[model samples]
Target: MPDIIQLLPEYLANQIAAGEVVQRPASVVKELLENAVDAGATSVQLIVKEAGKQLVQVVDNGSGMSATDARMSLERHATSKIRSTEDLFRIRTLGFRGEALASIAAVAQVEIRTKQPGQDTGTLLLVEGSQVTSQTPTACPDGTSIAVKNLFFNVPARRNFLKSNAVEMRHILDEFQHLALANPHIAFSLYQNDLEVFNLPAAKLSQRIVALLGNTYKEQLAGCEEVTPFITVKGYIGKPESSKKSRGDQFFFVNNRFIRSAYLNHAVLSAYEGLLARDTHPFYVLFLELDPKAIDINVHPTKTEIKFEDEKTVYAVVRAAVRQALGLHSLTPSLDFEGDVNFAPIRPLRTSTGGNSFGSGGAALPAPARAVEFNPDALAASVAAAARGLSAAPKSARCPRGPPSRPAASWRPFIASWASPCARPKPKCRPSRQLPRCLSCLLHTRSRPKTRARSRWPPRPWQRPQPARHAGAGPLRAAGREVGPDAHRPGGRP
Candidate 1:
């Protein structure tokens, strides 16, 4: 039997730790930038080649380390952030575990060059596979510049698992953006394969946002601020119209460190329930400041998840603050219930003098005249006049010798003829034969057939005498008596 349970070597342990600390090229970028920030750097520059697969470098003008300190910094668990266990509870720096550099050095080839401000010389240390290859004196600036090359080179499996250059570069950009936003006072620049992607100058938060996101964000941003004993929330939230269909623009930072919290995000979304569409997400860069003791950042290796002492209270405060900001900027709809019920919209009025003026600036116009009430008799008279007009014949269409006029009593025969089911034979028209004025006018106005237009002025059927087909068939008939051919004759039987 053999004792298989043995301690793993230091190199193997560091490599395993690298698995958690350096998931991809973006992870390496995060660690290096945070270290530069923790070192009190006011300006940081990042350069990458082949999307960080070949090389990733960070240069910072911070307090450089001495030769001894530079050599010891590569060792595992070597850190200057905290001295005792109590210090962990009050941690403020971005990197605290001191394992980031060691883990990175295990899986990649790392080179560090640093020099103190008053030192005559500097130190350049190179390491590969957790083993220091060289440490020598060199002439360099009073700062630190670390270059990581051939990441995951020793671990072929990890290298093979990486994504394409574009995808990896996107992740790198995301990390860079987070750091830049968290520290707007610090100048930052990024270069990829000699092409400049970002060169942000030191500026205020709003200016930094517009610089990073573009000028279009200038009008979409709304300021949010709230302070309390437990926590303080402050940041900018996008207007509802600026919301996006994707979820990449939302960010939450606690103590200037980015974190991911679904509960807190829900609080913000609930505040924007009616403002945003169901599939859309609002853009926000919210930062929460609270006592370090009230939350734990060491729960995860990445430190992007924190446990709050009173999450509910924080949620309420965050939601209220965002809602208030929207309302203050008039992004939210509001109504005034106290307004007068009879209030009417002001409109321009045209005066009798042909001048246009607003209702409030000019003399009030006279009221519209009331309409005249209806009169049945007058309406009936107007209708009768119109009917008479329709019956009148034009002067050009009149007979050569005007139709003979007869007594008004002659109208009774024509009315009776019009009411009959069968049409009566038309009577002859002659200057000697007279017809009522009304009948003459109606017969003259009646439309003749198209074929008869050139025949004569008055139709022959109404002009010459018509032979009687039967007795009493002329123009008139007695009541209860059948109309006959001679009914309309001068001496016809009743």
Candidate 2:
């Protein structure tokens, strides 16, 4: 190539750089949110449309820049965080990469309005595709409100690469959750399609978690804290049982800045190896604190990837801290060694198939049966119609009665025998096996032949009573037990 590196057009250079800094909508959210934090924002708001394809706005009450600084922020390699080569190794801020703003502005239409606290007026900058269209004086709040619109508008290829709105929204939520969790003291709000998803006031990490996730997490959290001469780790890791099938809940932040480190993530998962099911993922919001010099945040354009000097030590410490916290949490389930251990009796649904799907505790489930070609809903309607026709007939055509009802005590013996020593209630008398005989007597005598119990009992597996299988076909079979009443004992804990 002729003079391949001699000179690259400014717009093309920015677009090329954007590839590393803005991979998706989540990337934009991460960059903007980090900028807000770097600005010393105590409160931040994120609003998005079509998951930032159409718009992404981050409003922050931080130290807003002057008109000159605001314009310079959109230029490549223009940053306030660092000025010299040595500053690269001693990075402390969330955004040291001067590429985020330029990369974002290169692919989208960006509008920045800023005003310092004491400034009487603010500056409004309108930029599109790395070119500033206007920069004028305006009246605005004492903070910054940056809006990015029409993302990848000039880059059709990049625009085509975006995922669906729902998928992108989930990614945005993930970034918001990470930042919000790391800086729990900051008030954060999020809106999507004009509906408020989160409105968290400045609060403790635990409270912030509940606010971000939902109230259901209130009981599932366990606190973790560890400190050494070189590093300190603190935050909450969800209980082993509370893990999900997906990886949404895990979070790692170094010195209050969100980061992505598969090495550290593995450390967390390793700590939970035995406690969690193989397919489930534990939730954690851990914050690691250490000197800036020990970690390099400039390796990645987005600054989410960092390299630690003594990675192995950090990994071990993180793992131990998480494991120790879980151990101290009484919520950790314990095996009842005092009682008999029955392995084949029941396979408690250890991992759900959706959302929260991660862990090392999954009992290999039998593969599902292939579905046969049939429509059962139509069959059900036909059966119900036949029953109605029969019921409308004369008394002489009525079907014969079936069985009689049994007294409650008749079933006591089976319940008493199966009851575990760990059962919650106070001491109670155990019934005898003769209870089934009592039921037999009641069924033979007291129960009416024609009338059936009007109970809301769920249909039995065999009684699911499917359409008659073809006479020449094999016996209809299922791969797994369609759990009957006996499968899940009443009031039993999983």
Candidate 3:
């Protein structure tokens, strides 16, 4: 026998790991956008062609890496994020696992052009399937620009597993929106197929929300905030009226990292128990800030799922904040005081006939209608008079009827007897299946113990110890005696 254990090559290992981190084009979008945020980029630009199948470029004005760092970034498990296992419990950055760039490089053709402030010249590095094709000095800006082309080119099967362009684009849009919403202070832009989709400048969270979601949100947002020694919850939740059946509008960010948690979602929903329609979900962009040691984000490969040290505390804080916001919205009146017509300053009428149809004859429009006082007493009197007249009408005139077939006196007695519960006359009496005491003593001295078990003897109704159907098959016929039709009474009475 020969020893058959062998190690997987670095490139092969990276590709296998890529399957977990890069499931689709959207996965690449998420990883890259998060990396840009982690790099402390204030302005980021994203360009996609063919829904990220052919090209996905990300340019950022952040602290860029040097020549050695650029080359080492493509190697497996190479990172500047963590040094030991203790760092895993206190991770605050978005892309700290060190697998994003390596796994991405393993499956795609990637280009890197980066320059730091201190370096006079920039570095341009090209990689194909985890192999460096070239590395040289280039004239680029004082930041980083990474362009990924032909994603999954080496792994044809992975490319085949991708969805349609529209679906992939929607996923990419979702990731971009999440990042933009998470960091409103950072400017972000996206272009797809040479068409501008979004160009958001640095603004407050409310402005960022309007820029991405639309103007309708301007009126629907309600502020939610709660601060404690353990955690701090703050965000904007949509008013109950703006909630919908679709779930695309809900978001949750922990430490500025987007996450998905059904437990916490239920907490927010519980606060809106009676306010929401069935199957409808409210729109929210809640962010939770806590000490890094309170959460473990390394449980999953993508780092979207996390384990909290005390989940109940988080749930209580989220629920309380949402409920308080809803209460505040209720207290705020719906009317805009400034736009009320009643309080508007009256203007002088212009009696001109230029293009106004109302002033065609050069006469000012008629004065506005005057207010009229209503009399509730008069209205009530008229309603009562109408009710009195209706009641005075004869019943025959109100409901038409045909002549009766029989006299009322005849049917009255018949109905009374038929409707009576005792109308069905009972039998005078009938002999039961049980024998008399003298007969049983002569037949057998041993008594048969009474039992109401279903297997032995089924329980009887008020007078159902022996059904009428069993009358002809009774033991009286076997004893050669004609038992009179006198039955046992319900309570054993004569």
Candidate 4:
């Protein structure tokens, strides 16, 4: 057989890693922003064009890298965070994976200009397809400026897989939102085609949410805080009523690092069980702090999945803490409907004083019109039924006021007793047939064996059975007399 073994080039390996690390424009944004944070940047600016497929720039006034480190940063597995295998388990930084920059450089044209503080000159390096074309000393600021252009230039198939500009821009915004939430003390600026979308300064967590989403959520947030001997939880959860139609607003971070844990997410939703509608979800920005050894952060290339050692306990604690916070906020309050005693239900028409007025303003307006009467009984009973907490369904088509026939199966899903959709009055729910079958039917159909009621009828294996006492401790005796031989002799007299 011919020689079959061959070594893959460094550039090819980096390109393969790029497939996992840099999936799209947003992926690049996530990595560069993380690097900026790791550089100790308090303020970071992000700019993009054509949803970052054409241009992407990140500028941060962080602790910039030295000239040599700047050049070495493009190499795969080149990182300042990890040195030994033990260091991987005790990671305290976000960009330790080291594949982020290398993968990004592999797919796009990358340019880096960075200078550490007190350095006479800065380092400027340019690379395309993981091949360095230029490296020189240059005058620059005391931080890093990375610009990625023509993403996936060599790979046309990957470029074709990218989404539209608007869709991709939204993804970039979402990434920026999570990062901004995780670090409220850091200032962030986002610009698209020179039009500023977000220019947020250092502010409180609440301020960050309001600024990022909008002012509409200002009054609907509730704060949550809990500190235990093992872990600490602190952040905000949206009021049950303020939940959105989508799950786009929920966020969870562990030690300021964003994560996606369904197990932990269920803990959040479980807390809002009775308060929120079945279809609705509550919004939360929760932060969890624990010892590094208790969880594993290396489960995924994205560093979003973390394994916990006692997840059940953590789930319960987080749920309870969020529930307590909601309770104190009184986010879900009872409804109150009462007539305004001072005002009539209907009033007489009044004249306007503007250009379309009935008369000149110089003439005093006519005396206040008399109040019109309104009958409380004029409303339909169906309206009153809702007030009494009863579900007011369709009026059965007003079928001639006679005995009604069964409706079509189309309505069966809604009226089914087991369906939870009809259980609420405010939010309308459409029942789905795809719901899982219940175990109640199986349990009821199974036959059960009958057993004695005595508590000790079935003794444990380790315990001794009690002895039953008869007339004597020897063989069977009749009336406390041993008559075995005498009885046999009398019967055999012959």
lDDT, candidate 2, 260-290, per-residue tens: 8889989998988788887999989899999
Candidate 3 residue lDDT tens string, 1-494: 99899999999999999999988888888988887888889999999999999999999989988999988888777788888988877788887778988999999999999998888899999999989999999989878999999999999999999999999999999999999999999999999999999999999999999999999999998888889999999999998878898999999999998899999999999998788878899999999999999998888887789989999999999998898888877822355667846667889875443343544356655545589889999776543333333222233332112112222333344333321211112332122354222211222234334655343234234323432336566533222223443433343322
How do the residues 1-494 of candidate 4 rate in per-residue lDDT, one tens digit apiece? 99998999999999899999999999999999999998899999999999999999999999999878998899888899989998987887888977888899999999999999998999999999999999999999889999999999999999999999999999999899989999999999999999999999999999999999889888888999999988899999998877767888889898899999899889998888878876888889899998888889988988889899789878988998898898788764544457455655687555445334345445334566599787677554323322222122333321122123443444444334432222222221212233222222221223334544334535443233334456455333333333332322222221
In angstroms, the error of model 4 at 101 is 1.3
RMSD of each: 17.2, 22.7, 23.0, 30.2
Global lDDT of each candidate:
0.83, 0.78, 0.79, 0.79
Worst 10 residues of 2 by lDDT: 422-431
Ten residues in sequence with the least summed lDDT for candidate 1: 418-427
Which candidate number maximizes lDDT? 1
Q: Which whole-number lDDT from 0 to 100 does residue 114 have in model 1?
A: 97
Model 1 CA deviation exceeding 4 Å by range: 337-494
**Tens digit of per-residue lDDT, candidate 1, span 55-124:** 9999999898999999888888999999999999898889899899999999999999999889999999
Model 4, stretches more than 4 Å misplaced?
Answer: 332-494
Candidate 3 Cα RMSD (Å): 23.0
The positional error of residue 490 in candidate 4, measured at the CA in angstroms, is 99
Q: What are the models' TM-scores?
A: 0.70, 0.66, 0.68, 0.67
